[model samples]
Target: MQQSAVPELAHTHARPIHWVATATAVAGVIALSSVAQPGSATAAQAAPGTEAKSAPAAAAPPSTTGVTFPLDCGPVKAIVVKKATGDLDGDGRPETVAVVHCDAPMGTPPDGVYVLTRGADNPKPRVVATLVDPKDRRTVTDFALRARTVTATLLGYSTADVPSCCPDLKIPTTWRWNGTAFVRSTTATAHSV
Candidate 1:
């Protein structure tokens, strides 16, 4: 057997008191860690000399239900065919773009594209703009709201002789809020359906 040059230290041995001291030290560290906490996080820092202002809570999009659209649907009730929501006017709140039409028993009813918005004080949604009038005799299709713009494919007749059952002209249209009003623009050339 070979002999060691140095003797073993007393601290190296696992005594009951050593375990109690280690447990007490670990417990103290855990207790101190539980008492300490980090500050709340923020997205952006404010400019110098200005107080930090928290952003307002997000608002829900305007609803189309019970909104009396300007369309004159004789005896039948007007129904919302398609709806999309976004901040159309660069405002903090969202506006709803709804494609509404009469609940006719037969034949293709022309759709009315209406922009609806709810005021901060008013809870009910109101029609703000009429993008497509039902009187134009156009049916709305592929309607959507993207990048603060409203887009839709309008199906219409080229002339009075054209049958209502079969629309001849297809127009890809888009409406954008231009500070004061909703400006209409065509994305592509009109084609026959």
Candidate 2:
């Protein structure tokens, strides 16, 4: 008996090919492909019983799309207050920075700085962002908003024995608006208060 070389060659060369076809009334027939390009019409077309809804364009975040404020700011209480007006958003319009004495815990007296922008929808200004004392060890003794930089004076103690009623050490810090929020940009040493 002669070994059959022809039969073995035919079996080795022959392979099955699989194809899938999906049909939809609106999108017509589509053949599935492994490598599909993004944003292509065929890629976006819905399959079979499904319908495609167009995606909406991306909207800018509130912090980027600066709003004008005369917003209903609700209720706010402050003892020591100061206001600064300038173009903090880089826009031509002026933005108001309100530095107010905020309610704090028994040991700490913190001051809050509020950034408000004007809006046409309401006469009141809209509050955009607020910055309070960053650390818990001390209270905000004094603060000033100038040229977009918020400078604050912090009063604390160098030794544990010092009384919390009146802090002996004074630390000065500076925070600047970097588009999104006020970040502490500069740090200074403590001095006698």
Candidate 3:
């Protein structure tokens, strides 16, 4: 009598599948490790004593110009945000954006978006605007300056009404220079992991 061979054939086929899955997993880990490494350009240059500088150089800043902030918000204990510079006002000069974070009560420090411009005397690097308030619950997660537009990514309180350790929502907002000030051009929100 001839016995069924299906069981033997299935076992042989499953072995190759298992090997393939293991090989794929190993390849994925290698790729992730490469990305996890530091210093691959596109990093953020934070000022001394600021944690923001730790972020990878997120593309070369639009000409440092050696400009400095006029108003010292405080010691930059942490850099919650770092945005590249771009010619926002069409003045042929790039404007930089930085949102600094310092230690304070309620995990809500006096963090503000400092828009820096490299021009003028007395205060060569004067702040164009300081957008911050004591009542805001959103924190700057990331930012990018491109084509005279500044896009800020913010993490805000979740639907549970509690300020969790991690952001539950991501809000991407765009601002454009309207000859005088940066105006909101677009905005959208999504659930963050």
Cα-based lDDT for every prediction? 0.93, 0.57, 0.62
Q: Evaluate model 2: give its lDDT.
A: 0.57
After TM-score superposition, what is the CA distance of residue 123 in candidate 2 from its true location, in Å? 3.8
Q: How does model 1 score by TM-score?
A: 0.73
lDDT of 1: 0.93
Better of 1 and 3 by TM-score: 1
Ten-residue region with minimum lDDT total, candidate 3: 56-65
lDDT of 1 by residue, 1-193 (tens): 9888889889888999999999999999999998897888987877889998779998888888788999899999999989999999988999999999999999989999999998999978999899999999999999999999999999999999998999999999999999999999985578988
lDDT of candidate 3 over 23-49, digit per residue (tens): 999999999998899866785577888
Q: Candidates 1 and 3: which is better by lDDT?
A: 1
Ranking by lDDT: 1, 3, 2
Deviation of model 1 at 16, angstroms: 27
Worst window of 10 by summed lDDT in candidate 2: 17-26
In every candidate, how many clashes are there? Answer: 0, 12, 9
* RMSD per model, one decimal: 7.1, 17.2, 16.9
